[model samples]
Target: MTESDIITAVNEVFCEEFEVPLKELTPESQIFDDLGLDSLDVVDLIVALQKKFGVQVRNDERVREVRTLQDLYDLLEVIKREQTSA
Candidate 1:
């Protein structure tokens, strides 16, 4: 999938799973501050993202570093590249 596809899919997951407004989702949007997701909600988000991308990111150290929507998009891109290369 292209980067655009990844961004769209991730945004869709947030909209569907967390009821976040589409207008609120942007690359710079903070997942916790802007999106109103708490620690517990983040765990749910991680699960949703794993299911959406079909990738195991919950145990990945990089997950803890994600703070913005751009961060997530970048992380997924990296994961996708690593998977394909492997």
Candidate 2:
């Protein structure tokens, strides 16, 4: 799917599951600082995303570098693209 579609899905999941307001979830919003999510929250987020997208996100170096909403959207875009192609 397209990046916009990925973003839309991410936003919907965050809003529904995390109780994060739609207006506050900007591209520049940091997951920890802006969203007030701790490490455990991040683990839960990853689990939810994996289940929702049916994609196994590797616990790799790149995943650890994700810091913002845009970062995650970009990462998911890559993951989804690879999944579809494979």
Candidate 3:
């Protein structure tokens, strides 16, 4: 998938899984502060993302570094590239 596709899919997962408004999901939107997702919510978010992208991210160390919507998109893109190359 293209980068644009990844962004859209990631946003959709947040919207569908978390009930976050589509209008509030920007590149700079803080997943916790802006989206109101707490620690437990993050687990659900990760599960939803893994199901949506068909990738294993639950144990990925880089997941700890994600802070914004853009971060999640970038991470997914990197994972996609790594999977394809492997």
Candidate 4:
């Protein structure tokens, strides 16, 4: 998958999961601060991303590094690359 694909999927998941508008979703948007999502929502977001991308979204220290939409897009790209290569 491409970066745009990841961005689209992330936006879709956030919009559906958090009831947020598409216009508000941007690369710079912070998932927690901008979207007003709490810790529990982050767990759900990880689960949703893993299911959608069929990649392991591990609940580890790296997960905490996901702050902005760009971070998530980068994560998804890396996951996709690693999974496909594996």
- Candidate 4 residue 69 Cα shift, in angstroms, is 0.6
Pairing residues by index, what is the TM-score of model 3? 0.97
Clash pairs for candidate 1 = none
Per-residue C-alpha lDDT of model 2 across residues 1-86, encoded as one tens digit per residue: 77888888899889988999999999999999999999999888988888878898756567898999999999998888888899
- Candidate 3 has its poorest 10 consecutive residues by lDDT at 13-22
lDDT of each: 0.93, 0.89, 0.93, 0.86
Per-residue lDDT value at 45 in model 2 = 92
> Tens-digit lDDT track for model 3 on 1-86?
99999999999998888778899999999988988999899999989989999899999999999999999999999998898889
Q: What clash count goes with each model?
A: 0, 0, 0, 0
Q: What is the RMSD of candidate 2?
A: 1.1
lDDT of each residue in 2-57, candidate 4, tens digit only: 78888899899988877799998999999899988899888888888888888888
- What would the TM-scores of all predictions be? 0.97, 0.92, 0.97, 0.92
Could you tell me how far off, in angstroms, the CA of residue 64 lies in candidate 3 after the best superposition? 0.3
For candidate 3, give the lDDT: 0.93
Residue 69 of model 1 has an lDDT of 97
Clashing pairs for predicted structure model 3, backbone only = none
Better of 3 and 4 by lDDT: 3
Candidate 1 minimal-lDDT segment of 10 residues: 49-58
lDDT of 4 at 5: 85
Q: Candidate 1's residue-wise lDDT over 1-86, tens digit each?
A: 99999999999999999888999998999988999999999999989988998998988999899999999999999998999889
Candidate 2: the clashing residue pairs are none
